[model samples]
Target: MRVSRGVPSVRFVTALATVWGRAWGGSVSFDDEFGLFVCSGMRGGFARGGTTVGGVFLTRRPPTRALLRHESVHADQWARYGIGFAVRYLWEELRNPGSRNRFEIEAGLADGGYRAERGITRPDEP
Candidate 1:
């Protein structure tokens, strides 16, 4: 699967996220470092950094470099799976929710900033 930005499927997802960001009063900005769309101040809804909708990363607070990196991993998953990413992700969520999911594990709990409260440690970690 070629995950090019020129693809129509990817473009459509980006457009959908743009509309959602606008509706939620979230400001969209492109992060050159991570090469993803960041939508900040997107509060009072299903809060998350995502790629299921598009290459859009939604957050209530300003996104950090690490956060963008975490979301970029999700975007890669979206590109790899295309429309099926959401379905597969949903299935995974049903099986394992939160930091326990394999996807979140691959994304890295610390890098994803979801480890702060959970106090998770990798098998290799001391």
Candidate 2:
């Protein structure tokens, strides 16, 4: 869920998928077939497979609309670039943990405006 809009600069570092899911009343889980890895920490993230796949270390998550949108992007990346791309993303991040890249910015922007222009700030900044 979203925190106090009345307060700004209260930054917290978390996975983009988790934040988006929480905003829509859900949580994130890691599954070999289906898990979410933020772009900041890695190039590609995985989500667990379901139905079509059988017992082969499958990872899965609950069904949620927010998750679909957020995670689908990762799925696309994996498909386009294959697993090697993901590996490289992870490698680079492991070398430097301070990298907050494009995905972070995009996620923040998507979640940023809500109560502000809508006049939801409690007697706050303009």
Candidate 3:
């Protein structure tokens, strides 16, 4: 597990997310191991599995290890790209929705709970 210290601006965004998570009635806690603030039980205001803003992860429930692993990659992306990651991600998502998104591919489709459909053939059909 690589620990990511996002850039200053990204960290500031994370701090804001953390505060929002708490205000949204989520249980916020910093995980030293992952170096992320895990915010669970948010009433609303996230999409899909959850949302990771820099080092803060906001979710509706406790996350599975695979989901956390997927989200950690997003955190790394935020660190690498600073605050611009959000815009880049949106562009990528618009260009390639769902499993086709480059960031999602980089993060591992299976880990992110997306079906892997590249090379498997059904035994009966093929």
Candidate 4:
């Protein structure tokens, strides 16, 4: 959808996500570089390594730089699509599981900790 900044719906969704992260009892802090509210130390209630909702990234522990970089792209996606992004993302996931998902590919599969197929390998791998 590529919504512009200052959109009320986007802001509302972002704020809601932030509150959701807080309700999980995670420590929240803003990362100015990626424009994300990093919420770590969550006990449970998320998927995979973590999940980004609007401007918030929720995880069990501090994320690596590469993982943050990958998740930053998801923050941008939420900004672009607003609340609708969730439905779109779920559809994509249903259609293309794991690293095959276009959104994950856009965010960098290796950075998100998904093994790449078709002979592609992460730079850190031997």
Best by lDDT: 3
What CA RMSD would candidate 2 show? 16.5
Best candidate according to TM-score: 3
Sort by TM-score, top down from the best: 3, 4, 1, 2
**What would the per-residue lDDT of candidate 4 be over residues 1-126, giving only the tens digit for each residue?**
222252577677667766777788888887766667788988876789999877778898999888988888888888877688889999999998888787887888978999877855434445
Query: What is candidate 3's lDDT per residue for 1-126, written digit by digit as tens?
Result: 332566789878988898898888899987665667799999987788789988888999998878787788888889998899999999999997878888887787777888856753223234
Error of 3 at 24 (Å): 1.6
* Per-residue error (Å), model 3, residue 119: 6.1
Per-residue lDDT of candidate 2, residues 1-126 (tens digit): 122111222112223334543444443444333333322221123332211111111124443444334344434334343434346446654663212323212223133221223323322224
State the weakest 10-residue window (summed lDDT) of model 1: 44-53
How well does each candidate superpose onto the true structure, as a TM-score? 0.80, 0.31, 0.87, 0.85
Q: Model 3: runs farther than 4 Å from truth?
A: 1-4, 119-126
How many clashing pairs in candidate 1? 0
**Collision pairs in model 1:** none
Q: Each prediction's Cα lDDT score?
A: 0.68, 0.31, 0.81, 0.78
**Shift in Å, residue 107, candidate 3:** 0.9
* By lDDT: ranked, best first: 3, 4, 1, 2
Clashing pairs in 3: none
Q: In candidate 4, list every pair of residues with a backbone clash.
A: none
Which stretches of candidate 1 lie above 4 Å from their native place? 1-7, 48-52, 116-126
Q: Write the per-residue lDDT of candidate 1 for residues 7-126, one digit (tens) a residue.
A: 568668777887787687788888777677777787534445533256777667787777677777777777777767778878998897878766666666777877533655544555
